[model samples]
Target: MIRRLIFAFISIAISITIASSIKAAETIRPNVLFIAMDDLNDWIGCMGGHPQTITPNLDRLAKSGVLFTNAHCAAPACNPSRISVFSGIAPNVSGVYANNQVLREVLPDVELLPKSFSKNGYRSTGSGKMLHYIIDAQSWDDYFPEPASEMPIPHTLYPDKRPVSLPRAGPWQYVETDWGALETTDQEFGGDFTVSQWVSEQLAQKHDNPFFLACGIYRPHEPWFVPAKYFEPFPLESILIPPGYKEDDLADLPPEGQRQGPNRYFAHIQKQGQWKHAIQSYLASIHFADAMLGRVLDALDNSEYADNTIVVLWSDHGWHLGEKQHWQKYTAWRVCTRIPLMIRVPKNCPGLPEGTSSGICNQPVNLVSLAPTLFDLCGLPPSKVHDGPSLTPLLKDVDGQWPHVSVTCLHNPGDYGLSDNRWRYIHYANGDEELYDIAADRYEWNNLAADPKYADKLAELRAKGPTSFASKPEPSIQSLNKLTWVTLGDDKAPPSRPDGSQFPVFFINQSEAPVKLYWVDRMGQPKFYEEIQPTKTARQATRPGAIWQITNLQDKPLGYFKVDDRSAQAIIPAH
Candidate 1:
């Protein structure tokens, strides 16, 4: 009887210990809501970019949290830029060289930010352009209601009528009047409504587990679409043009460095005949994005998860408005690379004091820090492969020392890199170089590359860049008339075929001659055998691999490729 009594007492003690452990886990882990905007610059009301550009929702968010003023992107383009943030690796290290590369190919084993939360027992979900082209379905437990949109209709329905070509002049480009109205919306003629509505529903639903929700807004991107109401606020007459450019601004720069293309920023502004209209459109889109943000924030405030959730709002990269004669990203200029980053931690956390007002962190931070920071904020283990340190310390104290700098890579893959908070350096594949003191010349009006005194500083930065994986291996020409290739110039191929097999094939062809071909996999990489010659078939293999097979081919690609055989596909040119 004594033994039985002792066993009962031991079992009761074990139960109590187990319960305490579970409670500890629940209390330590905080939920997260990550909000990412597309092509947004430091134009918010809090940032003081413009007087009429009202971002009340984001302004209030800044009041409640910490803002990073000098944040920049690893790559200014969409695919590589977003991949760097999600993978916590720089574009060079990840091998995501450009917009055409698939992130799964570059960092196949790396656990994404959302995937980390899902693994830690949180209900991970996302909507809209959170992960570039499509939100990796595997990263989230729930991908539904479909990604949110800023327009009412599909993007494919709207096409720019202008001839397709690179622009020649700096900071000018033409935009069609109908370009902004091609998409459909939920309410107020914008698609942000759908994302807001979806987030509201998730907030209302009672869940037993903590949640990680990522909301991505597509507005303020190209085509600058918004409702008529938003346009009303920024009339053409009231819109202020950015500082004017001088003819000799970039005179000392090389011909290669000078702007080249008909559709470049200067051409757009000149052809449009109204630079103010273009600026107005961009501002209107920003305002609409802000309003949508307000809806999501309101939902969070009223929801049961309010006090427990951590909010992070960031942009993929900044946009240029006639600065340095550039309209889009892909440059290292402050107008093109610097983005708006805000973080709102719940009051329960031991970071900043409650209701913090307009705190600005001047340290240079990059999107690469987002993955590790999110993990740290949620009390998760730091990712072993991340290149960025968590900004949690800086958030608590605005004046904290975050001595690190950000780097952005432009054309020529690894060539033409820029390090933040210092001079901008551009190195060509041909060994030519250009340098600028960003602090002294915000507009990049002067070139200091030829200055012998600064040559050592330029060399130091060049030494720090990634040399091993600078460029991927070019694709191989195959016999089966099929081509094998890799994106971002890498030789690595996808692990599995479309049919879930180990074998895969890639194909590419000249645009002048159209031909159909069958590809086969051999020794992991695609080896092509001629299935049909160019004489008979009208359809041509536009790219060397399956992944490239799906991308729109008329535009320039980063030379990555893959193969798909689940179904026979045709490569058609854009009309």
Candidate 2:
């Protein structure tokens, strides 16, 4: 009788200890490790999209968390997709439907994703292509290598013959097309690899509170240039035309669907016989991106906070490799809309069961859902409104019965696609429609909109799309007045005009806020040359030893620097 009593007491004590540990975990806020890959498609090894796709890091990450196989971007292009993900606002509502549209002007009131974390006492730091080439000054506590650009590298492999010196193709929008191997090491290429190293260094350090650390990788996007070592694995002979490529996929009924317009990128590759070489380059870039990911993941796993950090890796949107006769992501097809998304919740997180550390989710979900989902997982106060549903349910149960559907657009609301588990419905701006049973036709080879039997089903999915599209917002006049620059640095700086030529001056806005520069004209009077906005530069004729004042939009003096003979030929810090 005494032995039984003693055993019962020990059991009760163990229960009490577990309860106390759970209570303690509830009070501990977790850190966030967010990673983003640029222009990546579902060609990773985990997705099983391509046989030769080698992405061991991405595949391992998928196994470590719930990999959402059917995830889609809120928008297809870079600016809109990124804006939708960060701002928690859909392109239809914000009217930020295209690139070159400044996000601050479109959705000025929305609190960005990182800012919400900062509001809740978390330190947010990020590096490289995180914000689609523009940094949100109010969001981050600090950023590495400030003044972010689209590409981190100063030059590509072939800098001289940009846009490919080859003949015309696909409106030749930007000279972004073309690829080759560089005779250099990964350290020598040093764009995304540097970003990974910086992020890794942060993970190694200790922080006072929770953190939101972001690492952005820009590769495999275009000009697919990586070290020659990455190219060796994918031999030129083994490189085959993408499996999705069809001989004449664009022979369809709808005007919008048949609208190949000016895109000869596919034709250009075929004519130049560089299709296999291009494929090899893309695969090499993907491998390089995967290698960089390995570095970041290694740092996180070896960090002091390894057990308390939530890791998430996502791509902005997928690219097309001659799929449906499309080149880059601007379509509503399954290939263009789908992206790889993985989230690994830490064991120390409160209320989470931590059952099955790795699971796969196949339900269609929107990337815009990320903003609200992070807020939910971090135990922060929810936003006033998020355009999409949260993925908390799917996170808890990979096969959870989620009624939500995914929607994505190209450049406008009407030009969008609505996708669910079994169907893909596209409604273009010109009143053309296309429907496909995704389960039957994975390649989207046939359009089913003409079938009368599926009309009722089409109507149901169409109702889930945007109700009414908002008008595209116009650029502010201040935004339109772009600044022009001239160079002025010290010492080695060119001699200030002894021959009556004005000094070549650089006038870039070095502040987070917009400012105007004023200098004494030839008449010895202070006059406004131009209002230099943030990230904009303007140059004006000024005499040597002339003083220039930079003031905020409200005309408050921020700082002043002089352009003299010694400083004239030198870069001036105009903060």
Candidate 3:
């Protein structure tokens, strides 16, 4: 009888253990597939802004998810805008004031979105451009480098190209057209191929671990290169020109408010009177990107992960195709500031009704809110320091009154703008201000800043302060040139040590004046210094082809040194 009781007790214990394990297995974390597009505007069929553009895959995704129609970027430039989204910190606060500003310098201790996920045992992987011009290697567990050439073929076949050129300011270069038989699909186009393939492999692995995969598409940014097949859909003659520009349109804009200039491709079109052809190229590029997106979505559907994966599709910022005579971003116009954002949560997630789609929410939303929103969705703790608020409540109820304002900042000169539900107010550093009822003047052709009736409204917006409101901490000077000795040769010849354990650093003379040397970690963190000089008694340490940057006062490149080989090199100007 005692033996019988022991057997029954053992069986009960085993059952309890099994039950606990089963309950743990059932608690699966939802995976995230973050896809970002460059310079994509409200041209997709899902947005209903462009009539002919067919983004069926995106449309389907939106139908299954919540689409935020009024999404804007904290900054319109590539680096600042992307930094804002990824870091959840405002550009002004983060000190990422411009394209060249490194994010790690401002938030050294802050873990990036992917890094945070990785820390919590989620597998984080990405390919192509995500962070900025420079990818932060420390953020991702795996990163596939972008291809060197962003072309369908090696080079253009037609040498004597007769493309038109438009009058513009800023860096616009021209190139002749070259055709080749290397007709690869947009999926296999250089950098895109690696990203698409990586995503496919990740899905195929079907690991028990949850994954965070981000694919950054670089098309629709410049050159507008895509397969002829995609181009065939948008015939040159049928391509609609953007709303016509009138000379009086500039009447309301300040001198600085005028459109900058056209890019090389648009300039070529204007010179050759092939504006329709240029538009066709752009549309073709967008179509190609959309098709790439479709391939990934199809892969998701085929995989077991589809039902549980949360898909978020966002564009870094919008583009301007001759809207108000501008051909690129970096403007306060709707075509430049307004971006497309779509979030498709898992069907089983709370709040959203299955297959329910919400119409446009005209309330202002910025990309800076993306980090917090993702964290809230994934049930992660958000960082205490972020400029954006989560839109989870709004997603739960479409009519929820989650009213907030969005502000976009332009760098040093301090031109900034504020957008409420109905109006947009822009203020420049020179004390010039403009106000427009965006509901009525989406084009911003009429400025009400000078009107006496709207003085209160202007004050309300301008009271928010300059775009660059955050003050940067003073840089540390002592840690600028401090170095530790590293081994030179593989031989065990008593590792050479520098005097006072400090290594001698050399500065390349790229400029007529002396250079400033700063030390940054692999994560793109910056340490500023007044100047660095080689100590007479200090021995230079040998390191790999990394570890140094030499720059002039204006922050122009001077040279770099390979730490492993102790070799120095100079940077030459590209003619």
Largest lDDT belongs to which candidate? 2
lDDT of 3 by residue, 1-575 (tens): 99999999999999999998875545446788999888888888877656667677778777777777777888888888888888898766776656645566666777788888898778888776687755676777776653332221222222133232233221122232212112555444555545676777778786766888988876666656666678777766787876533435666677667534333444545665756666677777787778778778888989989887888888888877766666667776666777788787765443232422544455778889988887877767778977798877767765678668887877644676678778898777677777998778766778898899999988887775544467543323222333233322332212221112222343333234555554544564435544643331122343333344555567654443334322223221211
Give every collision pair in model 2.
163-175, 170-264, 486-505, 488-569, 488-570, 489-569, 489-570, 489-571, 490-570
- Better candidate number, 2 or 3, judged by TM-score: 2
Per TM-score, the best of the predicted structures is 2
Reference-based lDDT, residue 132, model 2: 71
User: Model 2, range 282-329, lDDT digits (tens) per residue?
Assistant: 899999999999999999999998888888888888888788766787
Deviation in angstroms for 193 in model 1? Answer: 1.4
536 Cα displacement, candidate 3 (Å) = 16
Cα displacement (angstroms), candidate 2, residue 413, comes to: 2.8
RMSD of each: 11.1, 10.4, 11.8
**Overall lDDT per candidate, in order of appearance:** 0.65, 0.77, 0.65
Backbone clashes under 3 angstroms, per model: 52, 9, 13
Model 1 segments more than 4 A misplaced: 1-27, 146-190, 244-248, 259-265, 347-358, 420-423, 452-468, 473-575
Q: Model 3 lDDT vs. the true structure? A: 0.65
Query: How good is model 1 by TM-score?
Result: 0.73
TM-score of 3: 0.73
